[model samples]
Target: MKCLPSSLLILAVFPLVVVAKRRRVPFMNCPSTKSSSGLGMVKQARSRIECSVICLNNPECLSASYCKSSDGYTCQLSQMFLAGGCSGLPANGDCTQTFVVYPCENGGTFFHENRTCHCVDGFIGDYCHRRYRDCQETPLGNVLYTIQPFRSDYTFQWKCGPFTSPYTRVSEYASVFNFNYTLTWEQMKQGITPHPGFYFTGPETLHQLTKQGVYDLFIRMIVLGKNSGYVIYKHFRVDSEAEGYACHWKSFTRYYEVPYNSDEYLDGLGALGDSTKSMKGARFGTFDNDVSECAGTHNFAWWYNPLGCTLVTFDPDGLNWPTNRTGTVEIEKIDHTLIGLRNVYWYVEDDLIL
Candidate 1:
């Protein structure tokens, strides 16, 4: 047999190694809890009532389950989450344990039994419930996708690490919230190719100015072929903040950006202002055809990069979000992180105006 190359040999063994390392929960192994019969309450979980009883008696148990239909029960321990779905149990009697509760952005803290978060006054509902939602499903790129369908939207997540943090506190600029807007290509202004002017030369000109890459490539094609587009607005709440004696403040802002453009823009195809602000003239434009016919494809982008200008990660290893996993590559070492904090993005918005 011919000798195999090192790379090929490694590839052959990697799958076996990965398969062997897969997480396995031993069928019979679990934490040892006190048992009345000395073997513990290992029995079949027959009803929600049984589960509630077991959960109530065991101080450590958050909820409980029966190990088998035959005769044993196991109680999983501590923590009060929004209680529902259990039809048989009385709602008030379910979670009586005294512990602290915190809001989503409260550093996962706990103050006292249900004392940490106040249902922002004037709110009246069980647990002061506000609707929980995922990031708005706005059309990305030049694609004309409709709003998510009824009865069955989709499940999603915003795994924002330190990088995508925002620049200002939510309380300071509430009006800026309106920045969120969306458009179908039908929402864009329609136009025919005309004799070339500087405005018409945007894409071609942008191509000449910047090197080709994923984002730049889109700017080039749209500026040249179709036009620019806008992403629906994204916002971040002030998760946590502290005003230092030295007068330092840090915050984060998040938004989704779609390829936005206009043939008859505010400045008549002139420069865009700051990323956070539009030019005095740039007006919103729309197209009659589908946005999919345009050049850019809207997508999710974590704000900033590993730098964390908005959501500054005091410690990178702590959060573990270093690489982008797609499209974006990591910037080695936090010390090698990008700076300019807010200025760079502010200008990128300025440079990309049509």
Candidate 2:
């Protein structure tokens, strides 16, 4: 397992990358009314603009009411909008106003006119944060899914097509972890992996994304050396993990598999059911630490196979497909690997909704 020193240099050379700008959504304002109830947070604000800024910054604040009196101004933040915008009436011409903030997450469309979020397929919540894992779990009328495979570059663009009647998987790559944009070999050899770029989401970020709900992972390996131009696919379920960390994975099982191309179809990850599961359970290791015992040998950090170091992981070097199912022969020297979590649903037919 040789390391590409040049690939590591990419981290230092391109320290800065452009991030996609977030769409600015204006606050919905209502005049001459105070929140009668559902206030979860209260703070002192000198002006209504400050109250609106406070609501925008808070993750749990959905709406807020600003009240001006003789003494001072008070901002009451609510987790929800009571009675559409405000619950109370204006008493004696009191200066009270409510500002509604958009609560949609994960690229859900927010309608300013109605104060409602139209979630993309697979996400269901007041804020579209929860994700459905499969067709059986998704509700009807969700948009359909069709995978557009093998993208070489990385970007923060929303991959979902236009919303339609039928429910489906909205995006081909919902969340991606790219190994190419990580720290240099020198940094990694010292057991340091800094996730600074938009294209790369490190272990810590991955832990947060998968902690909430059931998720399926799609792994694609691009081989550049020995077996050049070979692409492989692996699919698996993320059962459980340790808090605040992503290494100690458990209860992993190979379920669904996606094909790379029409001519060659493979399910190489199915071999993880045996002793390989134990290998995955090993704590993550850096090159210097070598917790998995194979990280030093492979010149990469990963939850490596404890046994003889089987090639079955999202690690750049471990992106291999077995020539035989028994795991005897495998094509190695993979240059790049794309590991993505399925955050949306595949299409669910109306008849299957029972």
Choose the strongest candidate by lDDT.
Answer: 2
Once fitted onto the true fold, the runs of candidate 1 whose alpha carbons sit more than 4 angstroms away are 1-51, 56-152, 155-285, 289-354
Give the lDDT of residue 287 in candidate 2: 61
Candidate 1 worst ten-residue window by lDDT: 6-15
- Which lDDT tens digits does candidate 2 get at residues 96-144? 4454433556778765434456777656544554453323334543234
What do the candidate models score in CA lDDT, each in turn? 0.21, 0.40
Which is the leading candidate under TM-score? Answer: 2
In model 2, pairs of residues that clash are 142-166, 142-167, 142-168, 143-167, 143-168, 144-168, 145-169
**Candidate 1, 1-354: lDDT as tens digits:** 111111110001101112211221111111233111112244334443443444434433333333332234343323333232233332222222211112222122222233222333222112222211211212122222221111223321222113333311010111112221223332212211221111121111112112111111111112224333311111111111121000111222222245533222221011122233221211221222212221112111111211112221222121111222244433212221111111111112101000
Clash number for every model? Answer: 41, 7
